[model samples]
Target: MSKYVLIGSKGCGSVVIELAMLKAGAEFELEEIPYLEPGPDRDRLLELNPLGQVPTLIMPDGDVMTESAAIILHLADAFPDAKLAPATSDRQRPAFLRWLIYLVSEIYPTSTFSDDPARWQLPKDAQDGYKRTVDQYRKTLWGHVEDVADTPCFLGNDFSAIDLYIAVMRNWRPGRKEFSQSFPKLTEIADNIANDPMFSGVLKRNFDT
Candidate 1:
């Protein structure tokens, strides 16, 4: 109860929060749930979060916090010295909020729906087309970000959690290779995060694949 407890899976959305907490020097323990397949751990996840999602955080006061954006924002607020996000009054704050919400609300759902077409009640025959279409749509979203992205970071010189978000998210669905080819600027940001001493180890461990 002295520190937060994060429930998540490897290479999943939780990696962003894990990196954020690490960057913040927060004391927390990670509980890995085997979300890729069904088992006891997943059952535990269901009990904690009805949606059975990863990155469900249990606060020190026994409160439950879900959603990656909220958790990362909380960490940023809790440990401003970590510089994981821009301050509320900072000029970059609007851009930070814009993209963070965009990642979770827009691009993230494509992966969620595509992960299991059955969940959305799409016909089995239509599933492939659904996944393909969403996958392409996701790239379009990334391209929008790419158009505005800057070197070594998303918002120009200052690095924020958005960079970490990009670094991790680009590795999903269409994957790193396609990501590099289509969005070179964002790829540079990802590469910067991957090479950063503070964030690199967690990225490698979570995304060893």
Candidate 2:
């Protein structure tokens, strides 16, 4: 079986990629390295990813891969029966790739900036500014995706890895319904993914574990 050593926190979006693997019914071993102790994970994932990011995939042949996008796309390729991705000849392939990359390159980065605004060092008076910068970017990011998601899903009628990544952001800001309200279609996609029976156990076991 392929061995997947995920080096991230429970709250990290990489976990959604892992969840997609499980949902695809792929056979793989699981390992977790908490983000709180990133050094050990960084050192450990060197063979898999020089950058030492989580959601790294170690193939059965010992070839390693890193980055959430690469990992999930690989999984989709490996599990053809799951059909998490569009076919190569499909007309939607181009648009799908566009949205998929945008989620990682654009939306994911914005959420990261806001998720932990306090990480940046600043004077007490400047802390609010850092936080405000995060808020501004978050809204900008939300508006971006929501505007483009004119259909049921980000990829326009297909539920791809993009939805999975966005759903994890629901808990990022926490304690406010408006966090998701701004992005109506994006939020609906998140809720659909989270509320699905296929993901019921994952959503339930996620926070509890």
Q: Best by lDDT, which number?
A: 1
Candidate 1 per-residue lDDT, tens place, 85-143, comes to: 88888999998899989989999988887988888898899999988899999999998
Model 1 collision count = 0
lDDT by residue for model 2 over 107-201, one digit each (tens)? 66765665555676566777777767767777777777788785567777777777777677666653237766677787788778777877756
Displacement of the residue 198 alpha carbon in candidate 2, Å = 2.1
**Which lDDT values do the candidates have, in the order given?**
0.89, 0.69
Cα error, candidate 2, residue 107 (Å): 1.9
